[model samples]
Each structure stands twice: as C-alpha cells, then as structure tokens.
Target chain A: MIKQLFRSCIFLLVLNAALSSCSNNGVVKESSTADKMGRFPEKGDMIMLTDRPPQLETPLNIFQQDITPNDYFFVRWHLSQILTKIDIDTFRLYIGGAVDKPIAISMKDLKSKYPADSVIALAICSGNSRSTFSPRVPSGQWGNGAMGNAKWKGVKLKTILEAAGIKKGAIEVTFQGMDKGPLPDIPVFVKSLSIDHALDGEVLIAYEMNGQDIPMLNGYPLKLVVPGWYATYWVGSLNTIKVLTDTFKGFWMTKAYQVVNNAEANESPDSPAKVTVPVSHIKLNSIFILPEPHQPVAYGQPCHVEGLAFNDGTGIKKVEVSVDSGKNWMETTLNPEISKYSWRRWKYEWVPKTIGINHLMVRATDNNGFTQTSKQWNRGGYAKGFIEQLDVKVK
Target chain B: MLKKTQFIFIATLCCLFLVLHSCTQQKQPDIAKPADENPNTFTVKGSVREIFINHDEPDFPEAEGKEIFTSTCTMCHTLRYISIQPNFPHKTWEAEVNKMITKFHAPIDSVRAGKIVNYLVTIKGVKQ
Candidate 1:
C-alpha cells in the first residue's frame, strides 16, 4: 500500500506541473480532486471538447495506430438532451416525406430483410480543427481529434430508400437523430444531402461499429455513416430519414456549418457573410505521427517521420514531407489500407544532421489533383485543408 | 547519519502529499452540502443522470458584468464555451450575443444582453 501511494504521489506531482501549463493557456484544466470523481469512463488521453451535448476528441497520437479503436471514437451531438435508454426491440426507423408511403421499419426486420455489408470509412467533423483557425470562430473548439475511422456494418441506405419507394421530384434526403432541445423555439437538429450523394451505395445506416453494437455515447442503436464526408451529415443516434423535393434549409444546414462558397472557401471576418455552401467531403489534409508538435529528436540518430493523409473519396495520390520549414518537400511512402475511404499512413526516415529548432511540414495531394494549400481561412473553420507544421528540437 | 536523515525527511514529505491528494479526490459523493458556496452541492459527483457544470479556478477576468453573464448564459451551456474561444472583436460578440437571443432563445433581455456583449468586448474582445 505504501509503495502504491508513493506511485500516486509521483503522478500527482507530474499532473500538477502539467495542469499549471495547460490551465493558463486553457488547453485543459487539471480536473481537481472533485473533477476526477465525476469524470466519465473515458480513455485517459481523450479530451473533453465540450460538456453539454458532450463532444469528445481523440488524442492525435492514438491515430498512429491504423483503424482507431471503437471506444476511443470521438463523440459529437447537436442537442443537449438525448435519449439515454433506447429499447431496440420497439425502436423503429421512420422513413417518410416525398415518398410513395411512410414506413416504420423495425430493427430486426430492417436487418434481416436486407443483406448486411461492412466498410472501413472515416467520419470527420466539418469543424474538426476549428480551434486552429485564426480570428477564432467560436463553436466546438476542437483539435484534429474530432475525426475517426471505423468498420461500420449495416444495410445500404439505398436499400432502405427503395423499400420506402421514392417518387419523382425527390431531390434530397433529410435526416433527424434521436436528440432534441428543451424548447419549441429551438429548431430540430436536421441535415440533408443531395439524392445522388444519398444513394451512392456507400452510405450505411450503421448498427454495429468495429464488429459490435455501437456505444451509446458514440451513437448507439443506429448512426448514419457517410464515408469520406464530414460528420455533420453523419447524424448520430439517427432515427428519422425523410426524403424531400426541395433543398434543405434547416438551421444546421442553412445558417451554420457553412464555408464561403468560393473555390478557396475563405473569407475575412469583416467580409460580407454571403453565398455559402454546405461543408462537404473531407479535404486533402495530413498530420504528424512521430515527434508530435513540440516533441524532440536526437541529432545524428535516424528517425522516421510518419503521418496520415486523407481526402473525401478521391484517394490520396501523394504525400510529401518538408524538413526546411516548408521551403521544399520530398515524397514519402504510402501504406495503403483495404478501404479507399480510410486515411493512408505515410512514412519518411530522416537523420537530423542539424541542431536547434527544426520545423517539419507535411502536405498531401489527392487523386483529383487537389493538393493542400499553405493557408485555409474561413469564419466557420469548416473543411480546413492546410499543410501541417510540427516543430521539434534536436538535442 | 546525515544521508539517512535526509531520506526520512523526503519520505515524510511524500506521505503528506499523498494525504492531501486523497483528500482532494474525495472519493465518496457528499450528499448533504447545499450551501451556495459549495460547488459540490451544485454538481453531485456520482450520477450520469445529473448534468454538472464546473469552472476552472480563476475562470475569467473579474468585472461587474461577470455575475450577470454567469447566471444567464450558463443555464444552457458552460462558460468555457465563451472562455475557450480566441478573442474576437465586438462586432463578432454583438452578432454572437444577438444569435444567442434570436437563434438559441437565450432568456436575457435586450438590456442585459447588451451588458453581456459589452463585458465580452471589454474583457476578451480584440485589444485596442
């Protein structure tokens, strides 16, 4: 017991030091002794992005392992009040609106009626790295951890639409989750996608994640898995899927999560907020794996600089690493995975010959000739695709 | 003999630290406290059913507007939503405050909302 207490003492000291630095910058406050008692069962390194509606972020280091673990999957919800206890037996997904007829399909019937399929795909928040935006936009101040990849098992969304019997003039499909707000004035959290995007055969109304029933926190029972797209459209605890003839103008799609409609999708904060487009498709982005931001390296020792690169549907064609503060870059070897929708891991070995602070940069190019830009600017901080810089010191 | 004494002193210090840390952890949820000063009473530690809102020590810059800001805004969400953001201009804060009223239906009246906006602008807004 004494030895165990001694270990705990050392932990407290280290945590105190970490807390001092973090609390000041508001990186993460050291949860007081009181804070510790109330913390939910979360991965030690996972971060609480926000409390109400409960958004969580995965630590970037965990991404080094391909196929992020299911428990560590980031959680996000638009509504503060959620259905905690769901009776799967009685729970039926309602499909209606602009269809031949509205049908309430039971969970068992929905699965047994259609063949099940699995795909490893990434689900990223449109505002995944909103905190990094300058002139800081205020929403979920998340880092890169607001994204995850999972092998989702479910029936094709097209199959469900077919069962509902789509009529002519149905242009888009709107989705509503089992989350609600307290007041009637507060709009229902709903999002819609173009009918073509909805029926692409890849969209899965997922029941299981990583070969098991999805966790309640990460959208249990059912979730809309739109591979290669941002998670805003991938509604959690999804219960309602409605087809529409007109474009969706819900608060979620119209007034929020919008990027400037220009090609670059950037605008000054002072600029007129006009002509916006719904955030779609994951952009060509990359992140550092070994020697994370502010980490150190040894001079004259060989070390591999590794990271991951991903884009919406267009597969990653090239990923280049820069040693000289992004002055120039060289290509890295890509480790391809089974699914094209997943992020590809890249590696490049380098022997640090110079001493002092060194900057490492990474940029990726997707198959569609879309390469990352040096800077990405927007008010909403949606779909940021800027080249990443990792500063390290040679000791 | 001097080295032995030094080791004993270090051991005693560690033990004291352990006790202090355990006290802070306060494993059992205290059910009895109801005083306004007791933050624990506001947030019982043990229930998932409960929604507890806690703030960091020295959460924000102290000013006259903080009291109003805390009581009104935090009813729906945590103050960290505002504190965590990088400082923007009053133009941004004005739109944000208006958005709270118009979009989220924040209960603060126009006058109180204006005061809240002024507070945000003065404290966390762009430095003049």
Candidate 2:
C-alpha cells in the first residue's frame, strides 16, 4: 500500500508540472501602456497614411483647442520644397505690366503707406471633400481639419493697385508667390488673378493672423487673403505682383486646379476643359465631430453631436442633423457668430431609444438657400459635396 | 519493521536530493546567437553619422531662434504655422524667406536671415 501511494504522488507532481508549463505557454502578454494610448503614427506609418486612399476614418486630434491648432494642421503640398523663413527688408513687391507706373515697394513702405485692415476668414483647400468622390482622386486625403479661421490683417489689394495706377488692356493681374517648385515645363510657382477681382477691396495682402504674425505654415510675414476664395488662390510667401496683359497660363492657374466637365459626355481626349478658376464662396457643408466613427454608446444615453459650418460668400442660415438617415431633421444650436468668414460651430443632443445601428447625417443651408448635395463627377475632382454621414452602434 | 521503514524513507530522501542536484548542475543551452551581427549599421556608405549628430540638437536654437521666430513670425502669426512645411533648397527657400522681410516686415537682415535659414534647413529640409 505504501509503495502504491509513493508512485501515485510522483505521478501527480509530474502532471502538475506539465499543466503549469502549458499555462505559461498559453499566457497572453499584457498590452503596453503605449498601445493603450494611441500615439500619432510613427515615421514609417506616415507614408502608409499618405499613400492609402482616404476612407471614412476619423482625423487624429492634435490640438487642445476646440478649433484645430495650426501645427497639427493637415498638410497638402502639391509640389516639393515649401519655404520656411523670409527676410522682410529689401524684399520688393513689383506691381507692373498693366499699371501706368510699375511700383516696387519695400515692407516698411507698404506698412506706412497703406492702412492696415483685419478680417477673420476661413481658409479651406478647394479639394477638401475630394475623397468622397466615387473614384477616389489622387491627392492629399485631407480630413475636415484642412480648414481654419484667423483674423487676417493687411492692406487691401484695391488700395495697393490704386496707388500703382491701373492701365487699360489689363484684363487680369497675376500674383506670384515666393513658393517655387519644378514643373514639367516652367520651374516656378506663380498664379494670376483677373483684373476686376484683383482690384476687389476684399482681396488683401495679409501680414497678421489671429492678432499675431502669420506662422510659416500659414504664410509667415505675408500672404494674400482673398476673402471667400479657396486657399489655393491665397498665395503664400508672395514675391511677385504683376499686372497681366492677358489671361494667365501658369501651371497651377491653368493646368492643375482646373475641373474637366463632360468627360463621359464627350469621349474625345481633349473634350474636357480646364476649370482654371479659384473656388469662390464656401458651400454650405457640415461635419460631425463627436462620438467618432464606430464609437459605441450605452443604450438610451444622450450623445452630443457637434460640427462646424460655413459658406464662402453667404452666411450659414441653419445647420440640421438627421439621425434616422435623413428622413427627419432637427436644427442644431449655433454658437455665437464669430466672423462672417469664419465657420460657426453647431451642436445637437441625440438620445438613442433603441439598441441598434443608427445612421447620422448633417446638412447645412446657406443664407442664399444653397444646400449641400452630391457633387457632379469631373476630371479635376473639384467641388465634391457628398452629404457627410456617420454610423454609430449602440449597445 | 519500523527500522526497515526508516531506512526506506532515508533512501528515498537521498534519491530525491541527488536528482534535484543533478538537474541544477545541468547547463542551460547557450542562447542562440543573433541572426545578424551588424544590426544598427546602415548598409549604404557616406556617413549616417552626420544625420544622427545633426538630429541630436534641437534643430531650432532653443533661445535665439525661438525669440526671433516668436517676436517676428508671431507678430502676424504663430510659430506652429511656420514649422509645418518640410525643408526646401536654398534658392526657392530664399524667395519665400525674403517675402517676410520685404512684404511682411519681419525686421530680419541678411545675416539674421542666414542664421534663420541654417536653423530651418536643419529641422525642416528633406534629405536630397
């Protein structure tokens, strides 16, 4: 009986050792703290994000302010070698060609001669909603943060040209920024403006933004702030100001930013024509910021949904939110109107009554009765306006 | 019978001690050598040493550049705005840099401009 008990005890000890080893092998390593806190994509990941086509992914929050901060501003560089620093002195802005007397003015002279003006304007990429297109276009898949509002202070373009003395035969005035990149034909960064539009009082040569000097990213020292126009025309590090004799044919002005309409309508290779014009006026559009995409919420809990809305020329009249897939809509409360050009913030409280998938859609109506709708397909992928939608799952 | 049981117990304890002692004495297999020897060394030539060293210091001079960037650039804008652009070549960069001084009036001269460019080139410039 004693011998049998000893053998049984040995067998039990071996079995316990084997079980412990198996458990050790099956152990799952605890996730690191860094994994828990999702940091910005490391250097290797930026390329992946840039190359991958834009999807319905939420933008990574980089700033503490309700408004997206400037550093964390989404980058959209068409060409390479964007500028960093500039010397303000000895820098000359030439206003010639269509002007009676071509005037070259120094920075000091510009400040002293012209009256400084400030206006808060929203600078948005013309292709802000490009990714929503059916066939994804090839460009920076910018999220909503591609736009921002700042108080721009500068001399109005009309004031600058009036002093220069405009001449006839000057149908357009060309504005060239110091930003230079190599093109297939011309190795320079330049754009032109129509004479009538160039002389508009709203067009300005901005030196200050948000009560401070403009940052390098936003065109430090000086940048052109064409109120209500897309940022593509707001040339940065402006170096040349020429009064054009005729229509400007710069690469960006003519070839690149143009929208080619009727591509399928006309099957010919050259059937489509260049849009070649700066996007004017903000379209009525809204975005959903809170309860990010695919975020889960407790059943029957009130979720606050918020977003921003703005228009280029007209003021935003109302922003409406729909939870039942646009069948019914409710007007959201608008934050205090900051500036005519800056986007107005809006929010709505939503309580999910049922435990299921809910589709949320937001649409904005401008003062002029223009509402956001699906964009017509074009080659240049300009002015895409699909209704922004979000899907949320509730437990 | 008791004497025989005590002897058996002593023998069993001795056997267990010998087995444990032998197991402890057995040498663990030497750790497998790393697959590749030169792990950190770059395959290409021409000093990666400079890049490592250059990146070590905060590209912007902590005191001077910050002061100049804030006082001048921030007068009209924020420093966060300027740092966004990737670096550029000297020529194209010169034009934009001059715009601030000539068009915007940043109070920078040729000497100061050179310093600012040097600082910016280190931080923002893309490697050719």
Minimum summed lDDT over a 10-residue window in model 1 chain A is located at A33-42
Give the number of the best model, judged by lDDT: 1
- Residues A248-319, candidate 1: write the lDDT tens digits: 888888877778876556777667467888888777789887877667889999978998888887898899
Fnat, model by model in order, equals 0.15, 0.00
Give the residue spans of candidate 1 off by over 4 A.
Answer: A1-45, A270-273, B1-61
Query: lDDT tens string, model 1, B10-113?
Result: 67867776675565445433332223443421112332222233333226778878888887776666665775577777888888989888877767798899
Query: Over 4 Å off in model 2, which ranges?
Result: A1-68, A183-187, A260-278, A374-376, B1-128
lDDT of 1 at A235: 86
Q: Residue B59 deviation, candidate 1, in Å?
A: 4.2
Candidate 2 lDDT tens digits, A1-395: 56855775576557555654543442321122111111121111111122111111124343114444443334344333444434566567777777888888887887888898888887777777655554434444445655666678889989989898888787887777665443233335666778888877889998776666555545655688887777778887676788877778765665556654331211122254433344444556677777776788777888988877777768888889988888998999988887778778888999987688988898888887767763445544455455788888889
Task: Give each model a TM-score.
Answer: 0.83, 0.62
* lDDT of residue B1 for candidate 1: 36
> What are the clashing pairs of model 1?
none
